[model samples]
Target chain A: MDLINSVTFKDLKAPLFIAWQINSECNLGCLHCCEEAGHPMPDQMHKDQIFNFLRQIIELKIPYVALSGGEPLLHPQFFEICEFLRQFNISLKVETNGEFIDRNLAKIFARLKFRSVQISLDGATKDTHERLRLRGDWNKTVSACKALIEEKVNTEIVFVPTKFNIHEIGELIDLAYSLGVWGVYTGKIMRIGRAAKNWDILCPSDEEYDVFFAVLNKKIAQYDGRMKVYYYPYDVIEELKYRLRYPSASLLVIPNGKVKLIGPLPFICGDLRKHSLIQVWENYKQAWSNPKVVEFAKKVIEEPWLVSEANDWIELYH
Target chain B: MVFTAHTKIREEKFGAVIFETLKEKIFITNRTGKDILNLLQKGSTLEEIVDTLVNSYSAPITNIRNDVTNFINQLKDNSILTR
Candidate 1:
């Protein structure tokens, strides 16, 4: 696509990307899953509702979408959704656990020409990886990653650093390089979902963060531009301020059709199920300044622990 | 039909991307949007844009007009275009 910048929220008619939580279902029980996926929701988005949202996205000229879930690939109509998106110029990115992405699925993903397929692999060593990813098969994840790379699909490993996995950051990067994947996307694990339950153990200590920065730089140098390493330096206070100051252009669509802010604010801007996308978007533009949203942002800033209570979206505005 | 100085347009393989320098925001358009932007960059009139689209694409003239109008209005609303 072409390059355009120097813009304000007014210039943005629609979200450039939609982080659609396709379903509240997953097979793996990751220790820090933000969606806390496993059991499927009975009232999950109906097929018609999903296609309706897809039509809305097309009408708005959305260019990008990320398909995520408890496990997005688990959606029965996932391939159909990909085919539909292929009809338009929209680019897709998939977030998967890599357990179910066998050779056939990997081939299908490659054929679809996704922008990137990010698979979660918290640890480099099998012992460490399984420890973080409860019920996760290390061999399956590695094999799935290898299959994607073999099929020439752009693959990136999503890693979460904690005290257990902090020391393995370099090794994980090395492993990613050896696999010949595209990139390594990692950051401080958000204290939400199951993570909040076990934060006392999963949260990395200050000493471990010192090792994280050093090894992260060392691996970047060692890779020598062969692989991309994306590390988001997450600071809650700064992020809260920035998010409040700058208007958000993207809307986070949860599996239940609730439109909320991208980061874990927990304030529901509008419900896509209740109104058309345009109406919801119109409301969402002003939602940041809505007293409820503003107060929550300020509260999160002052009492960062409030984020721990943000496991579910709170319906305040529509 | 020229884009304002606030906007910088770059042509890409799929479509053109418009950059608003003031806000440092980007607008990614599709191939059709690229075609329209190409005409605007050349200072083509709105009627000429419609005429060109009518000749080039198989869509009905009404749909084409609406799309062009909406695209233009969006840009104008953002001050990327003045008139």
Candidate 2:
């Protein structure tokens, strides 16, 4: 696709990736899952809808597409969808919890040939992990991680920082490296979805989350590029240090798509169903001067009431 | 197209980005004497970009269009646009 000559939102060259959440239904009901599994699935975008949607993505020539779900592996047409999307020359990333993996699935994963696979892990030990995941299978996750490693597939383990598991951050990092995995990425539990429902248990206060990142940073520094780590908000001292020392490994992507500038804010960039992608980007450009949206984003960072709530417990660790 | 070598156009800020795609240039300014320049991309139009922001942010249609018109003129006077 030829590059569009017009620059609307801050001279954007183009979008490089799009994170598509096809379905929100998942088998495991993890205590920390943001997608909260029991809701009815939204109507699946029909083939034509998907085709039309994909045409916009193709026009941008985004090199990567990360397909996520309550558990994306559960989609009945999982493989077929992969084959179809493969036609567009996009590298794929399948995000899953790993309970669904097996030899047959591994073979398919290897064959379908995604760019990478990421399995979510809350803790390094079975007891700690099972505690947060409720009925989750830690052994299965470990087995799946090993299988992907053996296959020489690019695999990552995503750890969501919560009150219960934040104390053992070092062990999780060591566990990932010991298994010969590519790297580990930890995200702060934003107050949304099922995570919001269990806020008392999941959100460990901003202070605690900061301490958790600090401890993980100490351990992470020892490896020094053998493995990589990324965190959200990009405000942590550790992350700033890491970026200064080795800038190439970290990156951030807008989950819905980077089509508009008004993204990365509290308000959504309207429904893509009713408008063309170009139209979406254009409107986002005009929204930059929106006083309300700008004010909201500022308050989240400046006030961050959530930070105060987590500060007391966080001091102990830091 | 109008031209002024050192015209300064007011730039607007977006979510976490800014509307600075139009580099400094010379162009025609509307009656309000605002230069509207460098807004068009290969498949984009001034109206289309304004419409997208309006839809995404749920802004009032009338106000956004009005601001866009002023912005367009500002750019035009700066000679930042080809058309």
Candidate 3:
């Protein structure tokens, strides 16, 4: 039913969802590493800090949370954090490399009723996948996916289209189908961190992208909802500007509790350690109009130096 | 009778999130709408869905039917579901 009077993102008190980088460490520093995550950061949040912010999550009644990492499973208290969030009425999801998901972990995911588990696979074939990720990781990840799918864990494959792997999307779709995955999410690799450093070599040409999407669309129609296809073909600048107007709707929470508007642009709007989630959201809303942010966005569009500030958290003066 | 090829329905604690991948649009559903979508996913026909809602919910049969029909129509209008 349509509403009588509508409230949009501007009117929201808290974020609709959160993309929380629970830890700065990751298993593989792949070509598309937005965080450029490798080892845990020096300022990584302590368990107390994370739990404190989670308390704020409950207080604000945030409905959805998508946990990520370097690899989220690498976080020491990962299961404890998941259990804490599950106690509340939060709809939880995870983005992982799928290296750590085993039969027992998959069973735990099923028991916890995770909304979705996104496992990244750059390509269908081992050579391409290994080239993008770690060698032998493709096999480990695919095995993890099989475990999760076997336990009916609502698993989805996350593919980042690039110059290296766009050609094999047809085979990738078939692989997802064979694995009985719930969905296939193919999103554009944004220009940030490692992606920015490797933009010349990594970004797919427009024609390459067109061909890739054509194959993807054909498979979508052929499968006919048997395997869901989710594609996000957004330009980094456009997506950043869109997030500016609607910052409160969804947020990116970095490992140390700093809130970033978008990954491609370096703008830290708030600190969860210092403020409540709502307060951080209010800070985020103002960050969009921050002259520094506008200048940075423009500068990145012109010069290619945003790479230096890629993973830097440029805290706003709010 | 079924969701569109790229359409996905993910249920949440508060309600459900419907993804229309063709346009990259997202729609949120309340408990009633979520239940209707769940039934549709389970291959329940329109009449079966209405009957089930009428029997379970305290609303009148006509009202339930009206709500279900409108919800289904919205899904169809958005190209999220098809026969």
Candidate 4:
């Protein structure tokens, strides 16, 4: 079944996962850490703060939330927070590096009932993987993937294609299948965070990604339902026009109760806490219809400075 | 301070633009005036507004100044301007 149907860009459902980094501390410093890894642990969110935010999210009736961190698992009360959030009838999507998803952790993951778990693996082989992740244990990450699948959790392998691992993307897809992940998401390398700092080494040129996603679609076609695929920025490629048409079928509730109008715009158009979901939607309608805002968006898409700001938080976690 | 909202209008010549914070919605008639209206807003001085239009739009400030002064007068004559 093709996940993407004959929908135009206007029809796609809004995004469901409002991805936010609750903390910036990570145990492993990957070479391409978008948020620029290896920073000291940030002031962890107090339990009350997170719970309060989740309550606001529940009040807003948003359907999903994703908590990321340098390593969200590293948070002292990570599991407790997850358990606390389960009462709200909201699906949780966890984007983790998988260094912490061992047997004991797998039990916790199962209990949380995460709708989906996305683990990052840059290369299909250990040699290439270790090189990109820097002190990353490929075997351990693979083991974690196997554990999640065995537990029957919907799992996705996220491959951030950089110059280092661009060539081995085909092999990585095979690796994802071997582990029985529900899908694999090979994302483009954005030149915003550390990728910007190490542009020469990390950012893949247009020619490189052309071959990467080409092979990816070919693999998707070959495997059929054994796996599914999704991309970031859901690029405006002609072949992918069908995917854009689906009204972004997702809604993101940030820690501060901000309902991002679209996937992580540089500016917050309205706060869900201060306004109802319908109110927020109205503001977006107003903002969209406003010529000034529309012009600004056109400029943002055409210019790098504004786009870089919206993606700045990605660099902080990298 | 409950501010009055004008009818939202657009002009293609000056590109996509929204002129708010003026008297009850005035439909900007000329493309040149639309270019000036893009920068005119609350708390903006005639001088500051003229400066932005002159530097950014690159249409002589004197020409824009006269247009803006006339637009403000028209709105005032229509009882749209408070101050």
Q: For every model in order, what is the number of clashing pairs?
A: 14, 34, 1, 36
- Which stretches of candidate 2 lie above 4 Å from their native place? A1-9, A205-211, A233-266, A302-318, B1-83
Write candidate 3's Cα lDDT for B1-83 as tens digits: 98875565655554566656444466877767778888999999989999888888998889888888888888888888994
Instruction: Please identify model 4 stretches exceeding 4 Å from their true place.
Output: A1-17, A37-45, A231-233, A236-265, A269-293, A311-318, B1-83
Identify the candidate with maximal DockQ.
Answer: 1
User: Candidate 4 DockQ category?
Assistant: incorrect
Interface RMSD values for all candidates: 11.6, 15.3, 6.6, 20.0
The TM-score of predicted model 3 comes to 0.80
lDDT of 1 by residue, A181-252 (tens): 889988887877788787889889989988898999888777766888878776555666888888656778
* Candidate 3 structure quality by residue, lDDT tens digits, A67-165: 998889999999999999887747688999998888999999988877788999998998999888853378888999999988988898999888989
**What TM-score do all the candidates reach, one by one?**
0.80, 0.64, 0.80, 0.63
TM-score of chain A of 2: 0.77
Docking category of candidate 1: incorrect
What overall lDDT goes with each candidate model?
0.80, 0.58, 0.80, 0.61
Superposition error at B37 for model 2 (Å):
29
TM-score of 2: 0.64
Report residue A314 deviation for candidate 3 (angstroms). Answer: 1.7
